[model samples]
Target: MDLVIKNGTIITATDTYKADIAVEDGKIIMIGKNITQTEGAKLVDASGKYVLPGAIDAHTHLEMPFGGTTSADSYEAGTRAAACGGVTTVFDFVIQRKGQGLIEAVEGRRTICDPQACVDYSFHTAITDLTPEILEEMKESVEYGVPSFKLFMVYKKEGLMVDDGVLAKALEKSKDIGALIAVHAENPDLIDMRIEKFLSEGKTSAWYHYLSRPEFVEAEANKRAIHWAKAFDAPLYIVHLANKEGLEEVTKARNEGYEIYAETCPQYLHFTNEVYKREDGRNFVCSPPIKGKESQEALWKGILNGSIQTVATDHCPFQSYEKDWGKDDFTKIPNGCMGIENLYPYMLSEANKGRISFNKVVEVCSTNVAKIFGCAPQKGTIAAGSDADIVIYDPNKKFVVSKENMHSDVDHTIWEGIELKGYPVMTFSRGKLVYKDGQFLGTPGHGQFIKCKGRK
Candidate 1:
């Protein structure tokens, strides 16, 4: 064995127990007590710490273009932030240009991050152009190990939205090809009308951005997308689902046996529309904007129950200056939040306080994301034969989140000033100690692209 983590409690999606984890050749080789550490091999005595699978943030938009500017986090900074937050892998979107094929989209995105990422990652290709050939390309991409496709029902003028016809055809094709279709569910026409109405009335504050994209906008599109998915008897995953109305729709469909997979982000759980009243409130501006206290409570429930399966950071970042674009016109502001570094502490803090179990945190943060995105057993769990991706969490440690402590290149963090009691003290990617005690030791490009396979 090359390394041993002794006397630590391991938490999985369903099990929690103390064991010594043994690793060799970047894979877990044994997990049992009394395994003596061999000479010349590194030994980490994780006494009284919790050793959990590294988080897999299933949603992120690093280096993506929006409006006239691009998201601030590049692959190097973003993945380093991920490792600092105990995330060993991420599934970033491979946004498609109108004329690009699936394979080309993947390769182009790889050119951006392949040499800089500090953690293993994969792509969920966004299907912006729907065509017969693209439909066949979905199958080819699946054969190439990316089995998830993202389609947008909004962003009409930006050339990203697909109509109902394209959505339906994509759903049917996903069914045929064994792929999952993830959608940004929003009633774009209704939102457009609302935006025009709000702008005409001079209601151009950041709050109006939320009003323009009301909860009903998400509910209606979710219902409509599920309608098409049911028509084809297909599986559908809703990305960044934010409220009770959308959760209810997913629950109703799931009650009828539809595979209504969904995820929610920490921003929606931690902040609310009231933040728009702050001077820098515009910084919290994101599509399907965060809602009220009631919505936050409901989303927490969704996490507790089985309705919300994963907790991913939609870690799309724009610096404070980029947000000034929307100062004059709310529509012009690029939407997103910087969240890659706060994912683990936020959830683990909640778990420590009885809001959720520690095991549940591992499930939503790592295991379920892996199973849903087809990276299971390989990355989400700490069993033998799995990649030696792990985190040594110190439940007794405490820290207040601040921009100074953050690793992302962005100038600020939305998670600022929030104090938490639990955090990852050491992050191990494969068998390498990548991050430790507020510093990153891993080199860029140490992370590799994970070829994600389809659900069988």
Candidate 2:
């Protein structure tokens, strides 16, 4: 099949130019001035639009079970929503629950996603259990194309947090295999102690939860993780860093030439700890919960200064009814929020407000993510020979985020009622017109499993 997207201002992290992109057999065959179209080719009139590489959401949780309830969006619904929002790729986590082997956990998550996703996907194995056998399997798993591993520093008793020794050993192993170690940075002992104190004092609301695990807990953990990474000379990825202090730690590490990179989510950039005090504050409940206004502004500065490499949604979806699951006792609340479909729009809105540049938007949302994840130049830019994953975005369009317009199966939107300018009007995945103008045309199983190149 041949497709032509013409007359758009094509934006990449490096350059903006007027060009026509021609795709044939799911690859960019031509990209230049006034590319002539063949007979029977599909033509996309992209005049007055911005054509850029499709966004890549590096963090997402689909159908993940946490705190007694599963996230509402299955891989099918979540990736469909991602595609509709112009994200052509996702690097989702494969959970390693307690007592499950690392390989089994990887396979289980793969089973859930293999036949369902509508966009290309890759996996980052979450190592919640540290056993000799499981540790031994890490090299093999990395060999099998799952090159990055994540360990959490929270949920002490659950199948989430890893003790310091386990984390150290995992980092040592990852270094040997050249795999990246991603961390969910929070001081679990501090958080648990505070939570116990709060519960004993009869303070058990969503607001109390935010107070229990304060920004200091995250900041302390961030510094500690960086220390460990430096000690072992291990490459590290700090996921969903929510505060300024944490970004400062990341900046310090980068300045010292440490192989450390961090990602921040939209929740931290836009929402403050004040959300917890709202009547529906449980909707924003997440681990290392959003902090005060000062932190929010600092996080925006982190994005502008390049201390934070990428902006991901950390898209975790659950129903509003599940908000009760976190009621009365914040400890029972699941830790996540949904925003995969809103990522680019939110960043674009920031650009429209002059908070950031359009080139920076492409860098954070697409290019930088691809570079950190080892898919750079191939999936993150609209250059010749790259995958023809492109989006035609209308910068003047404005819309409010509501559950009624969302493509995910979740019953609530964390960003509901927020007005935003700019949206993707058309999305192409590897030369195929998968989403356009309120419709999805991709088939199931069209998404291929991408084998990521590990840390070099």
Candidate 3:
């Protein structure tokens, strides 16, 4: 045995049981009751603690470029933060900016991250154009193991927003290639109209950003995406779903047997649109900005009831100097916030407050993401023969979130000054200790690029 975690309550989506997990050569060799400790194995006393599979942040923007600036975290920094927070894997989006070939954008992003990441990583191509050439490249990219694609309905003038016909063509192509399509579901026309009206009225506050992109915008786009998915018989994933109405669309589509999946980010679950009312509200500006308090409650209900399938960080980081870039106009500001390191701590605080069960946290943050992104049974669960990616959690541990403790290059935390309970004490990637007790043990370029199985 290389390493053994003993005397912990192993929690999964389906079971909570006591067991000792043995790791040998980066694979889970055995998990059972009262396993004898091997002579030379490294041992961890997980007494009175919980062991869960490492979380997989399925949606994150590392080294992402937006609003004339790039996100502060490079692949190495972002993944390092992820490891410290107990996330062992990440599926970051490779942006295909307008006019660029999809393959070229993917390649460029790969070059930036290939030698930088510290944990297992994969990519989902953001499809900003659906030209015949780009769509053809989509099929080829799928063969290289990037099986998922994303389109934005809100970045109409800047990114991919197909009319009914283009959506049909893209979905049809995806069907033939066994790929999944994810959409940033916001109605751009409506948002632009409202934004123009607000600006004309001199209402350029950060709070107005939420008012301009209302829940109905997301709901309307979600319903349309669902219909398109059904029409083309293609599986679809809706990213960063913000409100109750959008969840209704996903639930209704699933009830009608459409292969539709939706993910909501941590900001939506914990913060409200009122966060934008602060003097420093610009720090919280993200696309589909945090909605009303009622919407936050509804999203939690959706998570508990199964309407929302995954909980991801949507970890887009920007520097504090850039946070005030929208002072003159909210629309001019970049839309994103930092959360790669806060995902687990924030979720655990929710659990401590009785908002969600501990097991449900693992389900949304770990299990469902793995299953949805085609890495299940290997990356998401603590079963035999699976990769030994694991985390030891201290539920009673408490810490205050501050910039000094964060691994991101960004200057401030969105949840700064917030107290948090329960954090990862140790993190392991494939039987190797990557993070432990506030120290990062992994080396640069140690993480391997994983080719995701195409969505079936």
Candidate 4:
């Protein structure tokens, strides 16, 4: 044995028990009562703590370009923050340019990420320019280990939106190639109309950003996307679903035996549109802006009722000066916030406060994301034959959220000043300790690229 962890309560998606785990060659070798320690093996005592699987963040945009400025977090900074937050694996979007192929985009992203990532990483191809040749490259992408693709329903002016015909055709191709199609559901025309009206009325404050995208705008596009998915009989995944009406559409389609999956973010669950009325409201501007309080409650209910399957952070942050670009015009502000380092800690804190069960926390934050993104037994479980990706959580450790203690490169955080009752003290990726007691131990160029499998 290379290492042994003793006296910890193990928590899985469906089970919880007391066990000692032994690791060798970066894989879990044995899990039982009182695992013996070898002469040269390292031993860790996890007394009174919860030993759980490492988290998997399936939605993030690190170092991505938007509105003439790149996101503040680099691959190294983001992945290091992920490790500090107990995330062992991340799935970032690889956006296809106007004339680039899917595989070309993947290679380009790898060239930038291969030497900087501190945790395991993978890509999801976001198609902006769909052609006959690009459609063929979708199959090549899946064969090359990326089985999920994304298309935007809004952002028509940015040249990222796909029309109904293109969406339907993409769904058909996904059905043929055993890939999942994910969409950013929002009605562009309605949003454009509302924005024009707001500007004409001289209402360009940060609150106008929330007013421009109402619940129905998101609901209508969600319903339309489900319509196309049903027409093609293919599985559809909704990314960063926020509104109650959109979730209702997801519920209805799911009840009828359609393969529809939805993921919600921490920002939507914890904050409402009221945050936009704050003094620094420009810092809270994100696309498909935060909804009302009722929508927030509805999302919590959906998670308990099994309508929402996963919780990830759409973690794209801009510096304070960058956000000031829209001090007068809400449209000029960047559309992202920092949450990659808060996903697991926030959810675990909620569980500790009795808002939900610890098992449900593990399911939403780790197991479900791994299963849906095709990293299953290798990444999301604590059993023999699985990788030793583990987190030693101190459920009673009270810590305040602040940028001073965070590892990301951003100048500000949306979660600042919030106190968390539970936090991760140590993290292990493939049996190697990377973070412990507010310090980073992982090196750059140590994280491997994961090739995901498709539905077969």
Candidate 5:
């Protein structure tokens, strides 16, 4: 054994037990009671703490270009923040260029992330131009170890939206290639109409941003995407699912035995559209804007009832000055929030309050993401033969989220001042201690690019 973590309560997706885990060469070599210690193996006493698998944040946009500017966090800063939050692996989007192939986009993204990533990562191609040739490249994409593709159902003006025919064809091709199709489900045409109406009426505040994307806009698109997925018998993954109606559609399809999976972010679980009325409401602007209280409650139910499979952070942030671009016109505000470093702490805090079980948090935050994205058996679990991606969680640790205490490069965070009782005190990525207490100890470029396989 090279390292041993002792006297901790191990929480997995399905079970909770007390055990000591032994690691050797970045992999779990043994897990049991009172494991014999090696002569020179470093020992970590995890008394009075919970040992959980390192979380997998399956959605993020670090250094991503949007709304005429790139996001504030670069790959180094974002993954360092992720490590501080106990996220050992991240799946970032590889946005396709106007004339680039899907695999080419992945390769291009590697140049930016490969040298700076502080934790293991993978890519999901976001197709902007889905021609016949691109559709044929789906198989090669899967073979290239990136088996997921994303399409926007909105953002028509930005040239990111795909038509219904393109979506259907991509879904069919993904199914044939054993790849998963993820969608940003929102009705673009309806949204455009609402935006035009708001601008015409001079109702251009951040509140109107929320109104432009009512729950039905997202619900209709989710239902329509599921309809197409069913027609093609393809697996569909909905990212950042926020509204009740959309979740209902996801539940219905899942109940019908379709492979419909949905992920909800921490922002939707915490804030609502009421934030849009704040003086700094422009900072809260995001697509499919946070819904009302009823929708928020329904999403919690969906989480408990198995409709929502994973919880991630759609963690794209802008500088406060950049967000200020939409002070008078909400259309110019970048649509995202800072939550990668807040995701695990917030969920575990809620779990500490008994809103959810600890095992369930582990399931949604780590296990389900790995299973859905095909990082399982190697990551997501603390068993023998699995990578030692682990977090030492202190249920009694208290902390308030602030930009000063966070690790991202963003000037401000939407999660500021949100106090948390439970937090990850230490994070180990593949047996390497990357973050502990409040310091980052890992080197840049230490993170290898994860070649993700197809989901089972």
Candidate 6:
């Protein structure tokens, strides 16, 4: 045995109990009561603490380029923040440009991430152009352990949007290749008309970003994507589902036996479009902009009733300075914010209250995310033979959200001043203590790539 964690209430996506967990060669070797410690083995007494599998953030665009500026968090800084926040694995997007081959897009991203990640990571190839060559290359990515693909229904101007025919072909490719297709559902034509109208009427404020792409935009696209995926018999995963309309679409599809899933983010759940009224509201600008408070309640209903399966941070980071670009023109603001470092604490804090259960949090934050991305049983479990990626959470640990106390290179946090009752006191990734008590103990490149299995 290399290490032993004793007297901790082990939590799984479906179960919880006090037990002793043993680790060897970066895997959980034994989990039982009163296991005798071997000589030279490090012992950690997790009394009164909750031991859970480290979170797996399924959505992040680390160091991605958008709006003429790169996201502030590089792979090193992003993964380091992920570790500090008790996330053991993250799936960052690899976008294929118009002239790039799938291999070039994927390998290029890997070249940067492989040497910089501080926690295990994987890639989700985003399809901007579904050419025959690119369609064929989808199989190569699946063979290389990336079994999921991302498609955007919006972003037409940025050259990232694909029309319905392209989406049909992409879904066919995913179905044939045994891969999952995740869509960012927002009606682009509607948004274009709305944005033009708003600008023509001189309604160009930070808040107009939300007004231009309202919940109905997302809902309409969600239904359309579901229809397309269903017609092609391809499984669908909707990312960043914000309002009731999308959740209703996902729920209906799921009930009709269509293979479908959806996820919501904390920004949508906690902060509403009202944030745009603030002076610094430009910082909250993101695609499929945050909706009103009713939408937040709708997302919670989806979670409570099983319509929504995960709560991943669409952690596309940008600093306030970059956000300032859109000061006079809301559309110029880089569309993303920092959240990889807050994924675990924000959810755990919600669980600490009566809003959600610890078990449900484990499901959304860890277990189901791994399953959805096909990294499961390896990255999301704490049982024997699973990777020793675990977080010891102190239920009583108190803290408030602040950039000064965070590990991300960014200078601000959207969650500033929000107090919390629980925190990840110790995080172990593959048997290594990577983070402890607000300090990062691991170096960049310590993390490696996880080979995800095909979904659907």
lDDT of 6 by residue, 1-456 (tens): 999999999999899899999999999999999988999989999999999999999999899999898989999999999999999999999998997887788889889999999999998989898888888988888888988889989899899999999899999878888999999999999999998998888887799999888989888999999999999988999999988877888899899998899998988888999999899999899877889988889899888888899999999878898899889888788999788989889899899988988999999989998888888788898989999999999999999989999998888988899888899999999999999999999999989999999864
Local distance difference test scores for all models:
0.91, 0.87, 0.86, 0.92, 0.92, 0.91
lDDT of 6: 0.91
RMSD of each: 0.9, 1.4, 1.5, 0.8, 0.9, 1.0
Give per-candidate clash totals: 0, 0, 0, 0, 0, 0
Error (Å) of candidate 3 at residue 273 is 0.6
> Which segments of candidate 1 are over 4 A away from where they belong?
none
TM-score of each: 0.99, 0.97, 0.96, 0.99, 0.99, 0.98
Q: Give one digit per residue, the lDDT tens place, for model 4 in 1-456.
A: 999999999999999999999999989999999888999999999999999999999999999999779999999999999999999989999989999999999999999999999989998999999999999989988999999999999999888899988899899999889888999999999999999999999999899999998888898999999999988889999999999999998999999999999999999999999999998999989877889999999999999998999999989999999999999999899999999989999999999999998889889888988788787888888889988999999998999999999998999899999999989999999999999999999988878899988876
* Model 3, residue pairs in steric clash: none
| Candidate 5 deviant stretches above 4 angstroms | none
Worst 10 residues of 4 by lDDT: 368-377
What TM-score number comes out for model 1?
0.99
Question: What ranges in model 4 sit over 4 Å off?
Answer: none
On residues 1-456, what C-alpha lDDT tens digit does candidate 2 reach at each position?
389999999999889899999998877878898889899999998999999899999999888877788888889899999988889999898888778877677777777788998998888889887889888888777777788899988876775888889889998988888788999999888888899899999998899989988889999999999999999989999999998888898999999998899999888888899999998888899877999998899888888898989999889877888877878888877878999999988887888778898889999999998888777677899887889999999988888888888788988898989998888888898888889876888876778787777775
Q: Name every residue pair that clashes in candidate 6.
A: none
Give me the displacement of residue 238 in model 4, in angstroms: 0.2
Stretches off by above 4 angstroms in model 2 are 98-101
Give candidate 3 regions above 4 Å deviation: 97-103
